[model samples]
Target chain A: MAKKSFFKRITLWRYLFLTLCFIVVIGNPFTNYYWDINFIQGWFQSIGIGNLWVVSPLEGLESILTAKFFYMPSLVGMVIPVTLAFLMGRVFCSWMCPIEFLSLLTDKILGFIPKWGKDLKYRKDLVRFAKYTLWFALVAELMITMIIGYPMFVWWSPPGLVGRETMFYVFYKHITIEAVIVVVVLLMNLITRRMFCRYFCPLGALLALIGKKRQLVIEYNASKCVGCKICDKRCPMGIKPSVGESQTVYCWNCAECVDACPTSALKFVWRDRGFITLPKGTKGESAV
Target chain B: MKRERKTDRREFLKVTLGAFMGGALFSSCSLSDLKNPKTMVKSPIKTNILRPPGAVSEEHFAQKCIRCGRCGEVCPYHCIKYFDVKTGGVFSGTPYIDVMEKPCYLCMKCVYVCPTGSLVPCAKEEVRMGVAVINRQICVSWQQDKTGLMCKTCFNVCPFSGVAIKIDHDFRPYIVEEYCTGCGICAYSCIADTYPENNGKKAIVIQPIKWKKIKEIKLEDIKKS
Candidate 1:
């Protein structure tokens, strides 16, 4: 059987997707002319690529909640992201989140960090999945603050803060505290992988809650498996995607582990129709 | 592979319960708490801040605006500037026009471009962004060689000249607040441009304010009369 090259790996594809998203974010400002076109707002808003639209559900929620009056058009803008989550889980985190993009960049620059420390102290655990609780807290906070008639500043959110700063830094030549906070976020990731996306991104938390039950999930075939734990080592988000225990809610489907699996037991199985795996031609040879 | 967390789901659930309990206790506060004129916690909207035309009232506008920077991008005059920390407090990054620098030309593009109704959509004449107040002391017309004969140049510059602004018997420009859409063209076109003696000031200034109801939209004007 022919082996997949390193560049063609799933993680690499995810990185490529991230790169495409990055281009759109910075390139959007230049594209907006008078009224003909607009790029996505930023990390806090949509993720448009080429002519395709990828909306931000969180923006819609914030506008509706904080404004206390719903605008039909803005509410309609949210359908794409919500539908994507319903279908593919929170792939936005793995595929296109700017924070995830920043985390990967910083990880590469500080490449000497001993491969995410395999020690049990650094191993994936229940606490790592505690981001759901953080998500709950933010939504709860939003409700309380809205009830108080002074919605907490959504601009102060990590994505909003960073997105604004990125605009100014790239186009306006000024660095506000928002930009400074983004740098601080990057530095924090040195201590762990994607600390902001894992625990702080309210939007991500919102997506995780919505996309938890997506049928397009990572499934494990334990029968043909060796418990080598290589998947755990390769996971950037620290997700465990084996033994029916994958945190599909948090998995971006970056597919790093699928590439890393020596047994080749790991493959995307479309659960909608009983276990349809990819690379159909290769799957037959690998199974034999 | 590691010892269990010191703070477990039990602690998490306990906090969640506390939040709901606190919420219940607080929601009991009367509706009058919201209506009390003497709001103890000084609201941010008390001051009349000019927002882009089509904006909701200051109170609702502040909460609704997502600070997307879209309206600013669409303005031909580049009048809309996002409020940074220096100018905007909690309202930073929302769109506001600096009339003295560059005023809205009644392009109506910004109102159209607003993704959220942070800037509402309205006809050019219906837009009541703010009112342009002409300062007699600084006005060149009033100061022209100390002659009581005012230049009335402001009337020539006013977009809604005959209606929004007019000259009284004394030839002094008085803004008929009812017609003034506060497009800031008078300030932008002020003959009394900033001179060193004035310490960089114009004869007219657009003060951000919310006042009396704007007359109903003239639908006839919506189409060519």
Candidate 2:
């Protein structure tokens, strides 16, 4: 009998965590309705228990920009998420975001269809440019929020829409047009896997910037690697993990690549090893 | 590769410059211009639709609110509801109370739960959600002799009772606009709407006060109240 790898164990826990986050996001309204248990309230935009709050950093930043005033409670609410990003390198993208959970499900469902299942191929430079577009979108979103005097992203944020739609369904018995936005984004996963997380999500962009120097990171072992590129194929973020592309801030610490590495060359280590320097003879392909 | 890089850089520069120019144009148009009453883009305020207690001015509420839905979640009476995307553009997902369906009980739980100060915490008495206006024409008590019906449902159900509502010499209900909190309990309990003869019309209805119209409602007053 073969033993299970540590990465598999982490991936299993990630799935469980993601499922739990989905339930918490969508089930709060039902629990509030049926059992009257509302100790925990809110969704991805801002969730809290009692007085302790965990607000989205991007939303908090927008609030600060649009309101044009320093609000103490909201500022305090941002501390937890910002600190988590600092330590964990945007783990929330994989482990907590309900939209990411739905995206993963869409990926799985798409896998059954032969033609649609394959990952979309793009030029190496184009992929890098696409990654850079996340930053561009983030800046554009924030500036728009400031100019418009409202947090525009919150209006159509996938996870927020899911949470609100769930609440609306539970209470009002009708779904709004926001649900269509969520459905469209989820359906787009068929063409490009996790497109929103990779190049469009402003929250993910903000987290990537904050978690750029995160403590926990995927470390590559050159000696153990077989140059099989399975990890590259497994990465949802479209980065090659075996050659230390996982070290990029875009890597959400999902450990999908780690789990896919048959030789156990890639593992999450709690140390900031910085960027990897390529070996003497090996070419660094798609290093970004 | 060198030529491709040059074009890419040029494309990036063009995009960034365009975005900067657009942003500068928008910023040049002052906030006051956007907020001007003459602007048709302003969200139309409805009469019976009231913001939850302690809500800031409508202009600031949409800007400050992150739409966490905590206000609706914490509402004990479940009267607070969100505006959907179709009905609400900037106002979508923000909390509102439709008094005719279920009126605010003034638990003030929603105010405390709001992470942003879109709904500031305040005393129940100081909450000016709107003012209740009594329609004497349909009121049962006002037309007791003619209709042979004497009902004081609004007076009995009012949270402020005597202070917010008072009886005239003829025992007809009269709303004291100064003291009315506009919680809409009176409108919700009004018997005039229940009577088939009155054609389902509420005698006492809440007329929402525009946040801009109330010049004295400072943040300090909200806190102190």
Candidate 3:
């Protein structure tokens, strides 16, 4: 057995990334309050860097749907995030989302409860069905946003609410009723694992769709795999990296499965392979 | 296995159908009212509540704003505040100025940071956040005969002192509405309202101008300036 170097651990790097993201989103107000430095402004929904902009693709879509016209500035703002998704395959979910950080924390807390923690896990197939159903619900939410003539999710979006409430608390010294939605979502994590990110987040769904053919993906070398299923158990998104299912769009590129692989068989690779490509010697059929 | 697969498929269909039904029912109830231009035409103009400078019409502002809170973040004076669900409905998360609390300083950083152009970039002199109107009944300077105090707090704080607000020979202040950009500094610094007898009423207040009024005024000003 060999000791893994600290830098080799993906989990440490991910936590660091999440922490930096939290500071960027929540610390903007503190900087404004104390030093009056506003080089970077805004929350998860939209961030303005100097004169450039990076807006959430879901919000951009909603704005276009409601306004019924293509706004050039918003279109320009969408380019950065859309390009990131095209290259990284929903890295924002694992790397930058504050809600995902909270979800990971909740999972750790739930792990401490005796007996009930094990029972809370759902069957894999049931979870898959629920994810698909919620993806459809995201579509319905966009339709409602169009019908209502406003971005409906802005009211309850967990990541946006986290930033909004933090700003309110910093500026006005009192958070409003909107912070309650974030609390409710965090509480809902008790019943389901990463419930909002896995099932309900429109931004995640949008990123998933945009990054469906992402260049960065998990590659499985079948010859080296021992089939110990450690990667399966360690996957936060319930993806099977051992079976090459980590190539799916829902894979957050968090590399938990790759980190958990005991045989060092699973690895992240930059390639154009479609979803679920089995190695040449494997008897399992490859699916696109 | 075959029976389980069939049931799963049936359940999926049932859920999808239920979602569509829910969306249809919800939209049917509120779609017409939201679509009506007449309802949207009535701007969200409340006393002393001004939108940040260069804000588009209130109707379009709600639709275009993504609620990024960038405007509030870049505001130098920290005068811009967001409305939560408790404070507003469609306007929730939008940036607004409560003139009585903290007034806009006309730095115009919020306009530049707005991604969707909800707050359009404009010159400081071209701002039309609102118009300042003096309440003669409450103004100490206006009632110089009775009070004889000659308090010039508002006149002293006006950004465009000589152009927007002017004092007469008796040191009584009057608002020149044409030149007033309605940045609200005058109302924020008014001493008349701070007096215990005034019961927190502002002597000089920024009355928010609707988009229709701005369009009429700006069209002529654009021709001149």
Candidate 4:
């Protein structure tokens, strides 16, 4: 058999994504030279701010920390990420999330240690509730902190860990009490893959819900599935599309399922369905 | 398509009202006063090798800052903090350089790092923060030399070197008054602040005291203890 073309075998976007991950997190040492420059730092800051715009839903659920939340210098917080989530379903998590990329690398490393590695499998549906529960507790802590005049979540966030290390120790020669909390969180993460992200990231839960909306999802052609289970087996988040009518809440709209289909049957279709002409034999039974 | 338009005119008005009230309530605090303190004062000019310290009034600082943690991040020294205030209104979630633990050595990291002009840059001779008035009655060196070796802790800690503070031959430390940058290092690192609780051995309140642009204190006020 003739060798498959590289384009037909591996996704170009995945490589770009990996490249972006390396540049943002691992390549920070090089990027740190320009960390203070307006353009470079502002890019990340703007993305963070972009999520703050449609944050009304997240904010309405209030905790103390978020209650004090105000739009910063730019309105980027509320505008960009929300618009993207509405359009492409949490692409930030898949392409740009440092934590997610790190977790994947960690999972690969863990795979070398015999039986201990086998348990480190990704399951989308099983851990979908983790984000929601984490959201609830985060909001509750915000409320409690507000009444008590203390911000409890600051010491437990991933960004907080990195920040405390950079600011308190690196710059000031001071070790914050939050260092202990960061160690404990990291230890827990070592035991469970993406334990903090799956179960405790309020921001992740908010994005996941936005992705879960019916219009903004990956639709599967159940009739064309043919029980190959290739898509299910290849899914990073362990979603089983062969058994379901819809994608899981945590789906990142990565189009992996489309890539995995043996028959050229999978395609992204909008629910609006504006005059898509189908073949005659195929009655108007829309794909899931 | 028109039906999905969830927000209408009335809803827009409500949001506007909420924002206006929130902004108004927030601006009416110390932050606003710091920015536009109903008064402005002139400082005596002096030549110096180091860059002079200048700051935007507190109100202006509070309003302009977005608290994105940029200045704090960019600081080579990381001496700034975003004070989590319950009552300071606009500045409640804002950042301020704590000049006590580490004075702004006039490195200008904070001024440049501040994406917004909350911490604006200044010329060498033009910068003037509030002056430190020595409370003679409460000062250990002045009060019968109670805990004194004629302590000059504040004089030694000032980032401006001997320009902001002076120690006489008798070792009595005095605020130079004119050169005082009001960076608050003396207040923060005051050995007295670290005394009292442990049989007079503790550091107490090192508050980032809010200053008015034209505020003044008489010597009698300092002597009142």
lDDT of each: 0.64, 0.79, 0.77, 0.48
| CA shift of B198, model 1, Å | 4.3
The DockQ scores of all candidates, in the order shown, are: 0.27, 0.53, 0.53, 0.07
Model 4 — TM-score against the truth? 0.56
Q: For residues B102-140, write the lDDT of model 1, one tens digit per residue.
A: 777887876755556677788778888878888888786
- The residue-by-residue lDDT of candidate 2 on B1-225, one tens digit each, is 999999999999999998896554333232322242422234434667878988887777777889899888867678999876556656678788999899999988888888889888887877888889888888889989877976877878887787778887777889877667889999999888777878999888887676534334334533443
Selected candidate, larger lDDT, 1 vs 4: 1
Decreasing TM-score order of the candidates: 2, 3, 1, 4
lDDT, residue B188, model 3: 89
> Which ten-residue region of model 3 chain B has the weakest summed lDDT?
B27-36
- Per-residue CA lDDT of model 4 for B1-225, tens digit only, reads 564455676688899998896565443343321223222211111111111145555434433444444455555554555443333432343455544455555556545444334456654323454556666656656654566456677777776555657776777667766556666567666666445543543232222225535335343433342
The ten-residue window of minimal lDDT in model 4 chain A covers A46-55
Stretches of candidate 1 exceeding 4 Å from the true structure: A1-3, A6-8, A33-55, A112-131, A147-153, A273-288, B1-49, B143-149, B191-199, B219-225
Instruction: Give the TM-score of candidate 4 (chain A).
Output: 0.63
Point to the candidate with the largest DockQ.
Answer: 2
Q: How does chain A of every candidate compare to the true chain A by TM-score?
A: 0.78, 0.87, 0.86, 0.63
DockQ of candidate 2 relative to the true structure: 0.53
Using Cα atoms with residue i matched to residue i, what is each candidate's TM-score against the true structure? 0.79, 0.83, 0.81, 0.56
Q: Of 1 and 2, which scores higher on lDDT?
A: 2
For candidate 2, give the lDDT of residue B144.
Answer: 93
Question: Could you tell me which 10 consecutive residues in candidate 2 chain A have the lowest summed lDDT?
Answer: A119-128
